[model samples]
Target: MRTDVLHAMRLARIDLTLVGRNTTVLFNVLLLPLLMAWVYTEAVGAEKIDGVAGRVFVLAGLPGLLLVFAVFINLVNSFTARREELVLKRLRAGQPSGPAILGGAALGALVLYLAQVALLAVWMRRSEGVTVANVPMLVTVAVLGVALFCLLAAAFSGLTPNAELAQVTVLPVLLVVLVGAPIAFPAGTLPGPLGDVAALLPATPVVEIARTAFLGGDHLSGGGAALSTGGQWMAALPSFAILLGWLVVAGLLARWLFRWEPRHG
Candidate 1:
């Protein structure tokens, strides 16, 4: 690796270490899963919805949620905090390139998401016997989701005035995921138009990919099927295009709008 890459990695490690020590981070990483598991189990039970159990929903949905939470919500707050402290401004004075700085922050979020995935896997295995089938697709979604959302978070942070408001910025994304991701039951029951719309959402493809891996292959077809064996690659192509488009737009927006010193600066 280049010297700048190494420096960026070091900075990423330091930021991730600091985040790991935060109580709020710990709560979101650890406690929130348990609460979600308990609440989902109570609400959905063990019966099959669209040929899958409530437990499968908990198993698949939790990881995707964490991916969004870490990449979108947590990273936005981190960027805002760093900007407020002039950390971003100081870093801009260094040898590291702009991409290196952002890449380092994204690497930190990826590490956190990986840790959360491990925890979620252990819980799912012990509690619900969740074993993934389409491992490749699952991995793709997780990696791409992280990248897309990290850019989104950084771009969104450009509009945020402070770290406190950063928390509020997550609300719209969170609500969409929580209320719109088709997590309450199964995708089989969704109305035709609504299901079609949900399929196009950034997180839905990832969630569907996760569901196919953990639950089974039956949910891998039609409007809500996580992945179609016939057009699986094709289906993924659109999402990849969308994610890349968003990444470009967000990167451009951040470049133009992000205030390193602060609104006051």
Candidate 2:
């Protein structure tokens, strides 16, 4: 309703449209999933890891990876790009509030996520016969994950010196999500301290919720299992609580530490 929110919304629309038109964004959002799905299928098929199916391997993994890519990496890069381009600085000079500006940028990522979910849902249904068991929990994780990561991304942007380095900063987190989370096939089979640590990482619960929905609550275990014991609905409480804590902490940090312009300025 506020003028600043309107301006931010307008700017976000243009930014998202540009990204939509860009071939690179298309490839990352579309082609990368297909490629990863193929690579994962091949890798698993070539060698059986703990008796997991190749298709189930790909299914368990890709959605969580896509969420991380969309929410964390993409949003951080967008904020950094806008800051380096002086868009954030100029916006600060306008009537829009900081929340509006950040929220607007998040809208673009949310749209991308919706599209990605739809595509993945249809593909999984047809190809793998995968049915989401806890639809509400999955939706909650998806939405909250996006919001939490967007804020965290904005917070990380405070430390990022430039747009180019933004991508690099996000890569460590991405690797953790991709390589560390149990969503990555045999990662579920990992033993001892390494696996224990991975289970507690931010991406783990999100992926757990997603996997619970995909695998019909059978895969939920450890923290996820303890959290969801009362039923699928009750199990989600812990995941939501953790995610909410992240959102609050990250959102506050972003608000307090965010730099509207270049560090040198």
Candidate 3:
């Protein structure tokens, strides 16, 4: 492997170790998702939507929350914290290139989120009988969601003045994301134009793709009407486009807004 790659790997390991040592980060990474998932699933109850368990629909949407809480939000906090401490500056001054530094920091979150996803998959399979029907779409959307959110975090962190301020700075975007996401409710159930708008939210496509991948149907259609692999792809094409668009936008934003040092420094 190249030197930069090795450096990034070392940084990623350090990040993982830091996360383990930080009780707050560890809780957010490990328990927050499960708590949120439980609350959502409970709200859904034993009710079925379109002949599919409402809980399954809720579980299928887990990736959206995971992306936000486990990756995006935490990363914003992580970046801002590092920047304030001059950790990022020290890293940049070293041999690791810009991409390597950013990649290393992001990888730890990605690895944790993937582990949670794996646990979610196993739980869904055993408890809900929700086997992944469209693995490719699932993986594709997951990668896209992680990449886009990581960029979003990096860019957003640039606006944050300090680690303490990150909590406040992230709320507005977090609120918009949570509300826009098809989490507590289905996007399809939204009336006409509202549904169209929801479809455009960054979280929407990720959840939609995950839903189809795990349950084999669109959110509105429910899992009873499982689609074939080809059908799943076709159904998810619009979502794919949406994610790709967000990825481009996020990439641009990261380039423009990402800061190597604290804003006030």
Candidate 4:
């Protein structure tokens, strides 16, 4: 057990090291969220959600932006790249267990995921004077959302015919998160039935929870109250359940479909 843990950690460290050396990926990981924050603010055009200002609204959207581009799509291509290269197959023949190997492969993305969150938080706090209302819940949702997306990315990557198809294969999630879900617009602005459907999507809850956490200006309201046009803290319970349900479902799918050997073999 300890051996697998150690191996996972070592593999994760190596991945992080490689991430540092890869200039283009590193640049995008650092720049994309910041760029989106600005673009979203401009697009929002002085709009507000549930009384929160436009800048803050853009701040809340940071997690979803990072989740899709930085975590989900990036990981989809990453694992597919590894699989196409037979990197995963070579690792499978080594000492680490399958679960450990997959977990380590995901660890780097998760780290990048969390780093984007922290960077955006700090950036927003500095520029927009935003502050986290509930650190625990905020961290919980961020971690959970990242894990969920990462697992889905793994499943998507594993299912893909080849690495070159990642761009096409990943469009559904990109569309769901970016176009289908409520990233740039208020959830309330959507039609009622449509909002319900969007609520069920993965990116919705991540945005919802983050919006809930940043609902207040200075301090996050301690008591769960009516927070946003979509839902409040307690009202967010269903979204949490949805995210958890998707996590389990996607996780099982990944476990079932994930292949260590090359798909051709």
Tell me the spans in candidate 1 whose CA falls farther than 4 Å from its real position. Answer: 216-245
TM-score of 2: 0.85
Question: On residues 31-68, what C-alpha lDDT tens digit does candidate 1 reach at each position?
Answer: 77558767877888886655567666756766667766
CA deviation > 4 Å runs, candidate 2: 1-11, 46-54, 186-188, 222-230
Give the clashing pairs for model 1. Answer: none
Candidate 4's residue-wise lDDT over 1-265, tens digit each? Answer: 9998889889889988987998877776668667867887887766655566666776776686788877777778788888888898888888988878877866777788878888877877897787766666677788888788888888898788888888899888787777766666666567878867876787887887776766533112223244443335566677688889989998998888766656874
Question: What is the lDDT, from 0 to 100, of the residue 30 in candidate 4?
Answer: 68
- How far out, in Å, is residue 130 in model 3? 1.8
Which of 1 and 4 is the better model by lDDT?
4
Model 2, span 27-52: residue lDDT tens: 77666866776676766663433334
By lDDT, the best candidate is 3
Candidate 4: misplaced stretches above 4 Å?
216-233
| lDDT at 177, model 4 | 75
TM-score of 3: 0.94
Q: Is candidate 1 or candidate 3 better by lDDT?
A: 3
RMSD of each: 2.9, 3.3, 1.8, 3.7
Question: Which predicted model would earn the best TM-score?
Answer: 3
Indicate whether candidate 3 or candidate 4 has the larger lDDT. 3
What do the candidate models score in CA lDDT, each in turn? 0.71, 0.71, 0.83, 0.75
